[model samples]
Target: MLHRHPLRHAALLIPIAILAAVSSAQKADSIHYDEHTRIFRMDAADVTYAFGVNNVEELEPVYWGRAVAANDPLPAPHTMPEASSNDSAPTVTPKEYAGWGGGLYPEPALKVTFPDGNRDLVLHYVSHKINGDELIITVKDIERAVFVDLHYSIDPATGIIGRWAVIENKTSTPIMIEAAAAATWNLPRDTDYSLRYLTGRWAGEWQLQKQAILPGETVLQSKRGSTSHQNNPWFAIERGEHPDEESGDVWFGALAWSGSWRISVEQDQLQQIRVTGGFNPFDFGYKLAPGKQLETPKFFGGYSHEGIGEASRILHRFELTKVLPQGPMPKPRPVIYNSWEATEFHVDEPGQSALAEKAASIGVERFIMDDGWFGQRKDDHAGLGDWYVNKEKFPNGLKPLIDKVHSLNMDFGLWVEPEMVNPDSDLYRKHPDWVLNFPGRPRTEGRNQLVLNLARKDVRDYVYNFLDDLLSHNQIAFLKWDYNRNWSEPGWPAVAPDDQKEVYVEYTRNLYGILAELRAKHPGVEIESCASGGGRVDLGILRYTDEVWPSDNTDAFDRLRIQDGFTYAYTPEVMMAWVTDSPGWTNNRTTSVAYRFLSSMQGSLGVGANLNKWGPEDFATAKQLIEAYKGIRETVQHGSLYRLVSPRDGSETSVTESVSSDKKQAALFTFLHSSTMNYPYPRVFLRGLDPKTTYAVTSIYGRLSKDTPTSASGSYWMSHGVDVELKGDFQTAAFRFDAK
Candidate 1:
């Protein structure tokens, strides 16, 4: 639900009077319907979306683009002209929600098969209701008892609309749903749009890919039983090839799903672009029983005429205020320190206490003890499903370590990978059938562990009970929940063969339910979702998680690109960026301490470096840098991000600026890969600031040009810009601006 704001009430007070001339005035940001014209117009922020019933009684898209005044004339609904006998009305017309029948050629919103072998299904508008910010439109099959309810809700703060559909089977026989989509969005005919999406592998995820939209279809999907790192469930379409960071019309969206999902961007025969996304149909089959219903995941979409950067800022605000758990007034993300880099699986009570002291000395707010603390988990080969503490490592259990961390003024967090089970663990030995596998088939293993079948009731209960008990016994304040592998040999022999395909949906549902229950039971504890890294980060998982590990590769240099592409769809509030050791583990590229810390401080800061190997200078530098970060963490986590200089295009420098919501505080970060021919950094301009307000600037790190002013008006900063004085390999700089 959207948080309460003045615009929310303004959206409710839509003028009902019909104007006869063009001189009439009406309030913006409203949703209204015209009975005579059979049109439904929704004005969200600066954009407008409308749809209505056509002459043939089918729902068709009317317009979706820049906002228009209420008195503006809109054409009455009419079916599109048919091209020929080969191109029927259903094929040419852009439908709001189309079924798989009546010679339809595009992607159908809903497809089903009857028990009597009849496949023809057509949907016609039945009824609609407007309640608060939501609009529900119901349609039914022409000659059957099947029904579909279309849901639309708009966020006043961001102009983003959430769309989904619920299908009901009211017939006496079961209906097999062959494929289902949340909603289909259509663009105007013959628009030159270029598609931009993210694609990458395990250690190298979130690489932005751009291509021109062709006549056929471009399918971006994940069939790995989870939101894979191969392709994220997000997309942005630019109106032309010349669109840049600051100017152009762009349309963007993201799906709120964690399971196997698919999004198809297709240009139809009439050259109309449409986006249809929902659960992947690769191995999808849902048998809806009589009187049962199925609801699809929500797909959110928005429009921005300012550019792709503004589109991202809009999504970022929507997520921080409406999508997250503690939105609108969320607590700041704590500066955390994880022990995995320090000792890995060799954690003990004294060693942990010593590390806690070092961490507390540097102002770490949360201490997370990563893997190898429980079961027989001395290595990746064993102790996954077993959730018990290691008796030999901690003779007095985790209480002493937890108590020690608590005494040092920090909350304690533990790492657990509950979805996986090693064959050498006691849990797997006792319940050999718990893992997902075909009967008598060889169970595939990743990281030497098999995925537990959370689709089964017994397995779900066991996993939940153990976690609940662990939290109930300890004073744990956070959990770094990790899932290390993808699904392989996914089978549930306990269920019937026809119903086995339900694992994809049921497993995700159970996982969400468990997280919901845990939050309800322990309201004070926070959770971070990590599937290896960036594997399961999506809107569905973000609803329960307080933060996310974006990637396993913490190399500061590589992360400049990784984190740059990440902010395109997600806010930095939930992105956990850690400062690891120099000579990075992934690329062996060493960066200075200031560079690494500043790179991580761009997002939620964390320290995963081995403190035991640090010299006094390292400790001193960390303490000072972290203090500077704390002064601006609020603005960094809940501010409008401006990508001044992108790290893409093989540029030698990268720059970003974050301005607070009130425009009073701003943080500027600059990085240089290497100096060449005595060249200086680019002139960086600040955005999202009040032009009339005067601001004072101070250096957080590095130095500015000798002639730079100490204070200036916001307009001066935007026009004249700032300059950095640096001449070295792997250099960094940061500055803070406070409104005077």
Candidate 2:
């Protein structure tokens, strides 16, 4: 429905000149074209777009004409293009790509080529209009080494922009790139603005302060850490959508280093514009021994006028696309109960069956058989390499145990730490080369285990097949894929010393490939990623799993902090925080049952305690909590979540609440950190409630001396408040409401 503005006379020459210059340049090696495919390959690299057609032939010329004929008034030319006559360095031109009317969808593609006469790099851009308002930009012939591709996309409907970057290591050597990519926006010079970065422990280094700029515009910046071959760093920027704002300008910049090849991006021209300086792609003189490649961790960034909160929502929507099916897949709720804390390392057929029995009794839907289910895996220090199920633990094999759980009307799950092998195991003894180690150096071990060298094709193939075989043998509804440790003594016998860092990034890529393959083969099975808890919880891993174990420390009190920190980057659905018994195994904090259940309800509600020991009262309370959780599952899972009170203030109490999408109903949970001897009372304010709606409040557990149900409209509850008194070591209460 959208139409481009008619070109004026002055812009006619622009397209002619640009096309002539492009024709004079060397012809690209490959050309691909298709209407349905937004991605095109030219020089061994893939270009992804938010929207576009597949055909390059049909797209290039049209987009070229538009770019050359773009009639948007240009800001004064800042600097003259550096001359090519200088023998000391290559000349460069700074170009500004503009997005106007909020629908200038930008699609970027990449290709690498070695120019005939020069080793220096020159990138070429081609644009396409495959769909309404969807623009594609393809850059060909960029010299490849270890470079990060930073690109941004804007959603036409929402006026929200999403940023994404990919690191392609064309060379075989590994490089340690520790840097952050930032997006800086230029505001109107006279505008006074308040800059704020979302606060949370996981919100990497961020700063906000006011400063004067030239008579042009103010600058807003958001920066976050880089991706090694091991990790990916990403950040997002939001420009609170106000009534007066006209256009939002965003520039993607990165600071990186490859040995001495350091580059940094800085705000320039007093906020009118910014630039990335200090680029030295050739400083290291590094080459990936033929047949090997390493890439910097990719970064995602964008600019939006929808405030930080809505910007987060848009970011999640983009991230969800990478993991969710293009078509509809079963929206299976991952309501799972893990046996690690309940059974620990002492798992057996009878124990698993008993646990499953207890789990089903309390409305548990998925029973995950955690560690100690495989090959003499009696303790954490041994039996890791051996992947076979221990017959002693399961007399008739795991099939019987899994069948038993399913017979009780619950899906069965299994855990595997595939990338690690314990030294005292059969596989390690048979193929010592499976473990990554230096030829003559001592291989360091953690938890009596060593990481598999995924860099080698043989190792990757072995691990991939092992997992495929395991999944094929069992009807696993889900897999608790745990990476229990971090990379240590980082070395690979198969890689040269100079390229050691490449192992980290390559290992992750191999992991992604393996996961991609597994997902394709067994589309029904769901995977839960756990890296000793939140260590590996990032957008990259979220691309592979349905959920993540927020932390191994699930004690209700600890999870208050854990879940609070997790929500900054991830949603509540993805945070698999649970409630378990206390004196807890780790902290020994004997929290009240209600308190534990309330904390667990904030995430995927699951139980990780010895349910067999629960008394009648405990059983009744657990049943009620489970039913209540199921009733509000959708609202809690998909609604907007806000943290009202934090437990980190050393206060004796904390509270959290979730409101329904329609704002018709709200759930409030309050926790008491310690028992109060006299006049113990806690008053809490409810959030996200509809003032017009009236509601009934009641205690989910048995009545306390001072506790009683009360009815109040949302306005009354918000103004007058609700209060509950507790006389126990730990306490919790829940309230529900409905539209009047």
Candidate 3:
């Protein structure tokens, strides 16, 4: 049943008209923007708030939330759930353990009573709150407890809107919680369905099934066909299967999926689970002292296809009462070239400048110099703590290279890993306590690195100032902000024992603060979010970045699946996939260069591999592809994306297309993974075309070199379909059509 609570101070709430106007106006504090949404941020007292609005709809509520907590609980051993009957509800029994400094603490205990005759899931937090718009529920002092808080809120005017859940450490001591947060939507039992999931990582198909047990043994049984398991945390289910798609409405809900964990603690320790919604999860966790808080963030639309799509549309409606005084919004980012895989950690001023010159020579507008330019950064083992230019590598310094790039008419970009620290670095040497660590415990390390405790003001200040200093000193046009790894040795010496689980949430909040500050100061610089590859590619970070490095693996085949999975929650424009050389960096798979270039064009196009090694013919091919991309840049960058083929179907080929909003132009790409005998020239169907308009088709690539205008009724294109022929191994064919 729907619950209705009257606004405590309805008169004080901002008027709808004013809120709409404010939402539409671009604010200086806005960090990220798209054709549909804008994000405005502010600091209220100690908490930082990110207010997001969908500028297209004035009636839409603002999407706002904060990270308000940071703490690590005492560690405890975790026991996996024994196989149980499907009819029985899972029971959690908490045991105590020793605290961080060797003091005895209560074992974590939890009892989830799915009482009869009740639809509301009663999550009894040892501590709970009812006042704020958002709350972060967390568990402290325990490492193995699976603690999560679900916050539900609704505005009478907005209906059943936003909801967010904060998952925390449930063990008495430290334990690594490796899980992806997911929400599975449940459609009506009679609904027709199909499922889609990322292959390789997990294997599964989305065809109609009577029953299915996901990776974590989450049973999703349907009486009739239902799309109820869409966003759940799925791991090794089955591999090499395509995600299923269907032709009916589907329902949705969220799920928190976990990986394995190593918990360390004694018995009898008390662990805390806290929850907060709305603003920041870390900040909310901080406000509550060893208890759960039920605060709401801003509105979180819903889980249905229509609901999610509507949320994006409505995000444009909210306005900011206050905005930082930045100038007009920056122009849409250009198709740039990134020197990451090409150089890795070997980049120096001269090398980078040379690469930049070569890139500029080929009409490459932006030259991004990837990692290895800071501190004594060599391998992944050390030198992350200090954020200084390596004079030994950049003898002439970055300014000259940036100046040279500008002289060559290209923008300069740099990479930074601010949230991590290497044990051997100067910063770590000067302040051993700066990294996240318990006073006397052996700190765990991942990739020979440690996570900086952003919960501490000193650490936050240092990171913020370091970035500010770098941006101030350099004429860097873009910042490729990367979070290469996840959290390990999760400890916050600065926070009290009772509030340690809040550290994770706090770390993320502080990150938001740093990004907010940077955007405010450097309004013209574009930020590209990168996480080891696609690890941190999510809507949450999208609010701060212009684009995201879709993955470190730019092989066209791999991206076919990666980009397909990404589209479930993200827009096509935000995904940054690139065309690189083959043999690929790792697989050494030599795909057709045309196939490689065409796949990357689906997102923000970039060249990641060395271009200097190309032969004359290859250079001509590269030039041709670049020219073709430039010709349709607008349509590809801004047009509607339609999935024409499934990568998961184990198909030997895949196809995708982008059609202009005016329906006057369309770009279609068909990829052939391997050779097929007497290959059926699959007449690829088209989407988003105007049947009413006659169109001309020209083979941008392949043997069909003539431009031909073919009359196609819009209704026929939709009902019947257009076809294209393909043959051979590692092949690609593209066609561009415009109204005659």
Q: After superposition, how far is residue 310 of candidate 2 from its true place, in Å?
A: 4.5
* Lowest lDDT block of 10, candidate 2: 58-67
Identify the candidate with maximal TM-score: 1
Q: lDDT score, residue 476, model 1?
A: 93
Please write out the lDDT profile of model 1 over residues 32-145, one tens digit for every residue: 666655677777788888887666667878778777777776655566778999998778888888889988898888898999998877888788988867889998888899
Error of 2 at 529 (Å): 0.6
lDDT of 2 by residue, 1-740 (tens): 42232222342323231222122122232223232222222211111122121111111112200111122222221122334344111112122222111121111122222223223223323343223322234332233443433344434323333333343445544333332222222222322333322222221211122232223322222111112212223223222234211223221222222111122222222322222222122212223343443343333333434244444444444444433332122252556677877778899999888888878887889998889988988899888868888888887888998889999889899999988999889889898887767677888886788888776788889888988988899888888887766555556666565555455446667887888899899998888877665545555566667887766777787777666555544567666767677788767778777778888888778777777678888877777788888877766665656555666547677766767668866776677777756756566667667787777765554333344346778887777666665556567766666665
lDDT of each: 0.88, 0.53, 0.51
Q: Point out the higher-scoring one by TM-score: 1 or 3.
A: 1
TM-scores of the candidates in the order shown:
0.96, 0.70, 0.66
Quote the positional error of residue 69 for candidate 3 in Å. Answer: 43
Best prediction by lDDT:
1
Q: What is candidate 3's lDDT per residue for 223-242, written digit by digit as tens?
A: 11111122211111111123
Model 3 error, position 480 (Å):
0.8
Task: Write out the backbone clash pairs for model 1.
Answer: none
Give the TM-score ranking, best first: 1, 2, 3
